[model samples]
Target chain A: MSAAGGLPRTGSALAIWPALRRSGLGPGLLMLAVVTGLNIALQPDFFSGASLSGNIATFAPTILICVAQAVIVLSRELDLSLGAGVSLINCVMASLPQDKVGGPLGVMAIAILVAILLGAVNGLLVAYAGLPSLVATFATGAIWFGLALTIMPQPGGVISDAIGDRYAGTLMGIPVPLLIIAVAMTGWAILARHRSGRRIMAVGSNPQAARDAGIPLRRTKLLAYLVAWILVALGAIAISAQTLSGDPRLGTSYTLASVAAVVIGGISLGGGRGTPWGALVGALVLGLVTNVIYFAGIASSWQEFVKGLVIVAALGFMVLEGQRRA
Target chain B: MAFTRRGFTSAGLGLASVAALGGIKPSQAAAPVTIGLSNGYFGTEWRDQMIDASKTQFAMYENQGLAHKLIVQQAGPDTAAQIQDVRNMIRSRVNVLMIDANSATALTGVIHEAKRAGIPVIAFDQAVTDPYAINVGIDEYDWGKHYAEWIVAQLKGQGRVAVMDGVPGHPAAVARRTAFMDVFAKNPGIKIVWSGYGMWDQAKAQAVMATVLAATPHIDAVCTEDGMGLGIMRAFQAAGRPVPIMTGEAQKSFLLAWKKERDAGHDVHLFARSNPPEIGRTAVGVAVRIAAGRKLKPLPDNTYHYPIKVEVTNDNLDQLLASVADKPDGYFLGEYLSESELDKLFV
Candidate 1:
């Protein structure tokens, strides 16, 4: 699929297919198409207003986290703390004193700052302190989780209606979830066009070479983490809006699931590969798998087994395609 | 992956039949009611049995042509996912919505939306505090209190008791912990030496119990919320200590384990009560009735407490054990009201 990279584009509708396939998004798109087709066939009304919106809304947090993880993964680093960061932000948002200035908005502004600070801490540990990303983030994840539990011992605090409605409502026939997806994609596109983006890829590809070539390795990596945390904070906000309540454990699943989504999106765990678009498709594929399993009347006992098998098979397919390309 | 042509044909036929059924006016006035069960968490064996029992009841109703099949959508432990599961069920226009809520308050907004959509929602197993929905479950606080009373009596009102709780801050966990703590306070002799949260999983309970055992050298009794008692027992066995006077739930595995311990000449005094899985079936029945325009006798708090099945002690252990001898390990040893039995609650 990468063969289309050096070829001149005809700039036609026919050319878009090969271009998408060349970006390593091909396998993810295929999986999404097949799974979504199966879902629509089984439920028939799967694309109807409420069902479609709910599907996207439920999976939007995962999509946002996927991109966040992609940012880190593209730098040959991992941030296991993103999930806990999201959880901490969610709890903080909910537990914001009702009498505080500006109420939820003030709480949200504070949360965004906290997210950036959390990201900066991670960046310092990995880039400045020279700690291995895995162990560093894991420890930070526990710290963040403990902080979240401390902030909201129970999952009971409320988010104001203004913020909740803004996240959950539709606009001009488009679901809020779709809007969130658009924002993430657009944000990534802008980042990819910037110089720091190229530096991140360079660092991931060969850090020593990039350093010798005069790139600021530490700052570029830190920038990637900063951007990733911003997305994660948005993810936390999305989760807060959807549930309209605070949970200390709200984002626990996202930690590993985001990584799973990144790999499934055709991104290499070794890093410096794949696109954010692929991550988007990968998240949608995972979401549809659950819906298809339910609507197809797969027995409850076998549901988890089937889901695992499908994911493994898709991963295998991606591997084979990668090998064929080489 | 099993998207076969015949499956598609049958699905089309099913839709056509549903549409045909929707179009017709039955002289007998039977409406093909669709009930949706949105279960939030599947971490426990109790949930498996609960879903199994509900499905069995739905099948029985379908066989009798009382309703269409129940649409069951199970999600992970995430609150947002479960809320979306409820929304998806609503989108399908299920006549009734039944939930085993992940949180008491997290899904309130979504439940309100379901009610606004003309769907009658019944919260069972995990009752929500939402006023609009029909709440059904065991009185968790009383369940804890009764067991605590038994433990206090077994200890003759004085002992170093260790308490094992379920997920901290969970509504049922909170109620159970409060009731047990209250009961312990009432009995001046009952001193809780160590307390730990077990999250209601067997392995988690076992690990927590091991830690508690390490910290406090001696315990007169172990008071554990059900589902995790078996694990706590395992911790005792692993440590090679005599099993203390313990409170267990009505899980078949625990009953069998208790009997085995008894047969092995271990002097163990245990009491277990029903936190029955059959409540799922009861909730399904209630949802069906409410959707059919039947008026239910309203309780002041909008909550209906189903009867506890059995409280097993040494005297009654043999009978309870024999009743579930042929059942699976995960089965809960309790009874729920049959369909006709549930009918009396309605006007």
Candidate 2:
């Protein structure tokens, strides 16, 4: 998948297969394929319009969050605050008066701006203030959550039906959620092509070396956070569209889920060695695992245990593949 | 794909045969229905009891051949995951869907999808705002009002009362809080000293109550929702302060604690109402009847209010304790209506 990002193509399919297998995305792709097959086998109506759209919409927020987390992870920084940031942004968007400045569109713009500001705060704390990303984001995550609670103490704010309808609806025969995923991927592709993106990877892979080589470590890290949070903002918007409402606690699950997705995608936890596409596949795999469990008629008492087992097994598989390659 | 087609045809034929079998029984006009229950937030003992009661009710129906299956999908506090759960149930072609929703409004879209697919949704516990879904739960406002009125009466409408609420922004908690505030507002002499969220957990309630106890002086009584009364009493006990008059819930731990307090001559006055986990059982009964082509009487705002059945006070604490003697400390006291009692709601 990373090879698709403007890497010169080897003419032969056989050449591409080994190259794909050698990349960090290999294990995630394998898991995704297996889960997709399992899901299709379990539910024959998986491609029916209602089922397809519902599945895509449900998977989209997680996918976007994974991509967002991937960007931060790629820069050797982790933002635990992304989920809380999403919650705060969702609350802000929903709480905005529909009759006010430019209505839903304006609210959306403001939400994006809020996301960037939140990213900048995390970035500033981690990069400029020299605080560890984990500690900084963890503290900021609490503050964001508190602010979200203050904005909407309980979950009851209305978003426009237009957003939800379009989100759940297809445009020109393509599902809106699929389009959202496409847009995020395209955005990542563009970012990957830019110099700042290379600097981020450099900083992640070897910060001291990158600094000695004249790269601005702090700026690169901050840029990665900004880019990542824009994706987070998009994810929050997607969530608002799905729920058609705001919830202060809505993004609670995504925090840890995104990190898990990053790991499942075979992304290196310590630094850069993965693609956002890998994260997308990883998110889908996780979502489909739940689907598979439900369709398999697993007892409710065993669902959580089974889900954990599957994830652990997938991670173990990735680790084994990595070791085999080494 | 061919195998799937053959399997689908056989499944259809099996259902047809079941319908043919049901046709012989005049009382069972409709075929047995498969009920799907989607529960969000299964962290509490109350939810476990709810699911257990639901399964027991489902078994009763299955025994009478009124229900074919009960498919339950339970998960934590993720609305998106719960939506997926509902979708899975819909795809599996469950005749009806019962939900204890994570959010009041977040589920509207999927609920609408379920409606479009000809699936009726019955929301219990935390009801969704969607009009298409039938809400079957206790009147949360009344529950709160009952507790508040008791507190006001015991305090003679005058005292510093510290209020401990359940999850902040939770629908039921919000409604109950409104009731508490409204009841307290009517009596100006009753001053609310401190109010904070306990998040509907015993430990959290205890922790928050400890903070309130340390920060404030002379809290005449504590008004709190269910699942937290024992924790509140524990906080007071840990502080070595007298357990003041307080509102409690119909859980075994609290009742046992209250009994212990009375036995110790602590002069504890209490009022507790059952937020019965058996509401899920009631909802199961309703869903089965609805699936069997029972016509429901026209409901206002599409909500069927399950009557609150039990309340414990100083007068009846011992009796309730004796009844639940074999139950565990985490046991919640609850009851569901009989089939005959449920029949009154339908035409």
Q: Which prediction has the highest lDDT against the true structure?
A: 2
Give the native contact fraction of candidate 2.
0.73
Candidate 1, A1-326: lDDT as tens digits: 46555547776865876666556677777788899899989998886776777787778888998889988998989999988898899888888874574876786777779899999999999999999999999999999999999988878888776776776688887888789779888988887888888888888878899999999999988998998898888788887887777888888878877877786787777778777677777778777777777677774445557657756876786787667677
Tell me the deviation in Å of residue A299 in model 1.
3.5
Ten contiguous residues with the weakest lDDT in model 1 chain A: A299-308
Query: What's model 2's overall lDDT?
Result: 0.84
Measured by TM-score, the strongest candidate is 2
lDDT agreement with native, every candidate? 0.81, 0.84
How would you encode candidate 1's per-residue C-alpha lDDT over B97-207 as one tens digit per residue?
Answer: 899988877787787678657777889988886677778899999999998999999999989999999988788998999999999999999999988799888988999
Model 2 C-alpha RMSD vs. true structure (Å) is: 6.0
DockQ for each numbered candidate: 0.50, 0.62
Residue A318 of candidate 1: its Cα lDDT?
Answer: 70
Candidate 2, pairs of clashing residues: A154-B169
